[model samples]
Target: MSRTGIATGPNALRGIVMMCLGMACLAINDAFAKYLTDVYSPVQILFLRNLIALPFAVIIAVRLGGWDAMRTRRPGLHLLRGTLWLAAATLFFTGLRYLGLAEATVLIFAAPVIITGISALFLGETVGWRRWSAVLVGLVGVIVVVRPGGDAFQAASLFPLATAFLYAILMISSRWVPAEESLWTTMVFQVLAAGALAGLASLWFWTPVALSDLWLFIGIALAGTLGMTLITEAFRFSEAAVVAPFDYTALIWATLLGYLIWNETPDAMTWLGAAIIIGSGIFIILREARPG
Candidate 1:
């Protein structure tokens, strides 16, 4: 970061690249999970996804500095985060079962806006009026996409809304963890938390996944891990406000992949909602970047 607290020069470019690649990786992970939702419970899929990702996360933790860098004083917070993660994943996958990739992603894209509102209301963060207005505008965009009583409406739309809310809560909860806490420890614990919870849920809803689909689960795991790592690196390299706008690139990936693989295309209203939400996000970034 430069003296102005923004990523400058090559650091800015690196952050942009990391954030863009991270969004693409996450999109790929979601696509793989969407494909599997056709034949498996979200819990079952989440269980395997966590299981597959665990060893790699542990390996990364170990390599981050062999046991020392993997320590955390906040196990309870990590478990809470993991539970939120598990819920968000299961709800999102459930939404995917009925909604197109772009539509679902657009709704989930409200997470950051929700996070700001949460911080101001509950965390005592001094969010100004401009950011609050953007949150409302972003919510209107969400309502347009959801279309409550319209023929396009479905109960499944609530899943992503819930996901955005839960995700915001998850992010806010992270603030409670001490700054000295190891991210690797948080990462590993959350995965284990999801694994433990999902494993229990699987006992009741387990469905046998075929040998053919095993590869898809592994792909989900790998893509998700790559996304998480890149996103972490992105924040390390640049200011959150500087790189956050780039995260919107996930919509493009979701739309393209949905059309190519599943023959799904979002309508004009979806695009309109997406544009509104994205514009609000950009505005929030601009507001935050302005020096107080």
Candidate 2:
């Protein structure tokens, strides 16, 4: 483990690489989900995606250890984390219906900044003035993109903002989970819990999916599960602060996919705001990495 006791080692390069690839996978998954939104409710999409991922999570769990690895002392925390995951996914997918891929992506990227504050408040972690200033700048960036009362504003914009908050809470909670709990087990619990919750919500909004769309559902599930696994491994190898900055790579992927697939382009203000948010987030990560 690293000197910081964050349950990661000192291999920052490997962590950064894994995080970049994982972000790519996640971006592709989001693109697929956005495309499928044309035909399915977000609830149905989430249920199917998790259902397909459950078996893969089980396989990884058993391979990592026996079924015993799945046993955890912190079941309640797992449940809470899973709920947050479900909520974040629901909000993001719903928001995608109204927001372009790049715009939605830049909005959610605000999570890291929100996480810094949440860590300070809820986890009682120390935050220096520099980091706090960075957080404020990041929030300003988000406001610039959201433009609360401007013509660019839409109620749907709030979905990604809320998603970012919930995602921050989920990340903070992960830090509290016992390090001994295998990554596979943590992943399994999260998928199962999210799937169960989504399944319940699906009953009210279920719609028949065409046979042609089955592959898209499977792709979403595989991409998301693999991305989660890679990011989990990334954290195991390096400090979260060291690896997290790479997540901004998703903006690049989102930009390319948005233009190629839908001809959607983010406005100048959106790009400006994204630049500010990303810059502030990177500063926070770098500051946290410094010796205190």
Candidate 3:
């Protein structure tokens, strides 16, 4: 079936479930990246992650169709999307070095709200007052979590917020991509383009990896590639708004992983802010799901 044609009966439910699974993989990947940040720079981590993931992506692309499946008329758009992906990953990984996993996860959840706004402004989609209000409330949740000028705040906290904005842009841009393009093609471009860009940047900050750490780099590649492929498939089988809210599930995974692996815990304020953000995001999803 064509990529866009995958959205059919029962696919919406499947999409939601797949999105949750994808988020779990992503949360685990983030934890691994955070752990590696202790010894490697963000660029180095990004370069390795993308470089390792590229082969798997290429395999998937070929399975979907031969090399011709990866062809695209809109190279510039793919390049732009790839650049945004690189920026988002770099910022989020860098922020993870300082912020607790759960905190960073919650902040990134704000992307749905930003995506809603961007869809309205740039995609020219009609957004009702209710969803707009939800967007505003979601921003409040972000502010609560950041707690700017307060002791809980770190300048690094802004990195995830910026990442969320860039990710929102990437998601919006994806909607513009021709549906006929194979999902594997898009995925391949994302890894290849980001890998090339990060490879150039890693030259200055490169750090030698111990033989023992090779497994971590491999894990990063597998988790990231698999996670993103599942999420992309979820979007293929469901509406973006329908699949998006499930992304908030990442916070739950991140919280558990953070505590077990790093002994990190989110304070009461962070929990409260997360609840607010999640609530607002759910409201937006519900509003969008309704008939106009």
Candidate 4:
């Protein structure tokens, strides 16, 4: 390990370790969220998760940049981004109530693929025919996974796919947010906005929490914090291209967790569809990496 506590190496081995651990943490977060879904509303989960994290976000900002660290040049953008984040979180957890964790995770990964098209349309960025073709193939993989016309398909699967689009918008806004804005500012706005919105929305179907479920709530908060911290650092240390495809590692972690914790084994078709989505996603990444 390096002095920073994260390992340092140009080798794929170390990268794989970091990537797998990061994804495992994220999968654990999702698993906890799914379990809580049976009892808690999306807003409740969001409130508790961020309430546990909000103080730390403030502390981090103060430690790193003092009071000024929380400053933002664009309140409107912050509100807009927080809305997207809230929408993504709500839809994703709502989807979880009906879909398996692994299935939902794969569908959400479609966000980046959608982002390519969004950028082409809105940002005037050029997406060549080749990349556009890859996007179509990726959508086909999604259709296979969702299998809309088939009995295997659940209506809830669409929620995750829709959330993916919201996430893409969140990411696009993040890309445009002023660079001078501190991470603390961004984190604060996101947690506060999502937490408050979810809490209010959950009022319609709120349930009393048992003492035991409270324990799980603690785990959700801690694990979520850890997972998001790792993901943020992953972006800092590695190139986006290098770290992006590593997100597919979530499928592996979700599969294992689904088996061990929930005993939910995805059928053959799910695995096959996951493989196609991942393979096509990697192909898109590689295409971006190559010289024009």
Candidate 5:
């Protein structure tokens, strides 16, 4: 019923499946990126990711509607979105350098909670006490995960925390963009700008990727592009509220992959914090889903 022609009717099963699969793909992509970080800078890794993804983005735009699909008088929105995304990815990847995969993922998963808090503080949106309490609980969850003064905590934890904040702002600003703008248009802008920006930053840190590691780069590109497309499809098939909750499935993927690949086993506190964050996020999602 919306301008984007997304079906938000009673049938949400498709959306749920797409959302879960999308999270899985993204988790796989992150695993690839994490593996590469040992030998490559985050900037270098992301610059190459954007470079590899650019062709796919262009092909998607062309297939969707050729040049017409990419037409947007308001280029600023797309530019800003892309820039924010680049910064977010950079910070997140850097965080992975020091944090375990599941730990880093749990922190970023607080984005929904951050979005709610940001709306109240900056957008002048009215948030009832119940929602406000949930937001507070979410922040507490973040603190528990960060454990700033604890032996287990690292300063790098702030990277993902900041990623969550930037991502929240990115999501909010995206609302200013008209629905008439094609998704591929936004994607192309993201790939181009992120690549260019990261490429510039990578000048000091760039390393030649060996042929043996070329497969990892390709894997990162494929999983990332696919994850982005599938998540988009998830939204198109169902209402935001319907599929949003399933985003937490990324944690499951991250935890399992972390154990199998990196031998990561999160402490009980990490799981506890993740549960609190996930619960608060679900509370916000459910509140938003009410019929109003």
Candidate 6:
């Protein structure tokens, strides 16, 4: 997902397909993460994943262009993004330990709606009445999904919702980041910074992983780089308002993977809530895309 510029040519359409593929890969990654957690510490998993992924991120950046192209005016912003992303990953993974993958993911999607408000108040981006209404409606849909304070609510479900604001803030900063900064540089910084921190944290309770788990780490690295690139390209070529709704693709993939791999079937209430959230999200995107 090269964020060089708004992609053009036949490749633009291809980006959309790649984006979907990326979502599928991400679903696979999450499934694998959940499986590994059963046998390994989540901190161990996070540390190794970043260490394995750092080289790939650097290589991708170099392949995209030289190290010189990776230069950024705001290393601070990238550092901040890396730190928050670590928190987001750790929190979401912890939530996954207790919540269904699809459910946690749906909650994270709340970031888009959060971004809308952030853009309006902080970035001074104009919000038309339609988008404002969409934001409100999107919140209603999230409420339908979470149903907080009720016995039906899953307490662990709130973790992703809490972490999502961090993810949203990271993404918002990414938008303002210097365009010249190679995606690879940003990615490299992310992996290295987070890996180092997680490694330090894991020192208190490091568990030895089996050889086969090391192989899984390799796969995690590659899948993460590819998924991140594809998703970045997706946003570059397509409007965020248009492309965001397609994120529901992850839920379908997650649900299928969860059922087959983990034997965890989402209940009827889960399905209904997901449908409301996804359907309303797509509707919001469509309304925003309409020509005014």
What is the lDDT of every predicted structure here? 0.90, 0.90, 0.89, 0.80, 0.88, 0.77
Model 2, runs deviating above 4 Å: 1-12
- For residues 54-86, write the lDDT of model 3, one tens digit per residue: 989998878866887679877888888989999
- Candidate that scores best on lDDT: 1
lDDT of 1 by residue, 241-279 (tens): 888899999999999999999999999999999999999
Tell me the TM-score of model 4: 0.90
lDDT of 1: 0.90
Off by over 4 Å in 3: 1-13, 121-124, 237-242
Model 2, C-alpha of 153: deviation from truth (Å)? 1.4
Q: Give lDDT tens digits, candidate 6, residues 1-292.
A: 3343323456556666777888988887787777777776667788888888887777777776687745677867767887888888888888889887887887877777787778898999888887787778767767877888878798888788878788889878888777777666677777777888789888986888898788887777677778887787787677665456667799888888888876877777677766766765676666655555
Model 4's alpha-carbon lDDT is 0.80
- Sort every candidate by lDDT, greatest first: 1, 2, 3, 5, 4, 6
> Which candidate, 1 or 2, would have the higher TM-score against the true structure?
1
Global Cα lDDT for candidate 6: 0.77
lDDT of 1 at 270: 91
Candidate 3: residue pairs that collide? none
lDDT per residue, candidate 2, 174-286, as tens digits? 88889888877788999888999899999999988899999999999999988888888888788777787888999999999999999999999999999999999999887
lDDT of 4 by residue, 1-292 (tens): 4443334367434455566677888788889989999888887887888878777777766775678777878878877887788788878989989888889988987887888889899899899998898888888888889998899989999999999999988888888778887776787778777777667776886788889888788788777766766666666666556666888989988888888888888888877778777877887776776655
TM-score of 6: 0.88
Cα TM-score per model: 0.95, 0.92, 0.91, 0.90, 0.94, 0.88
lDDT of 3: 0.89
Off by over 4 Å in 5: 1-11
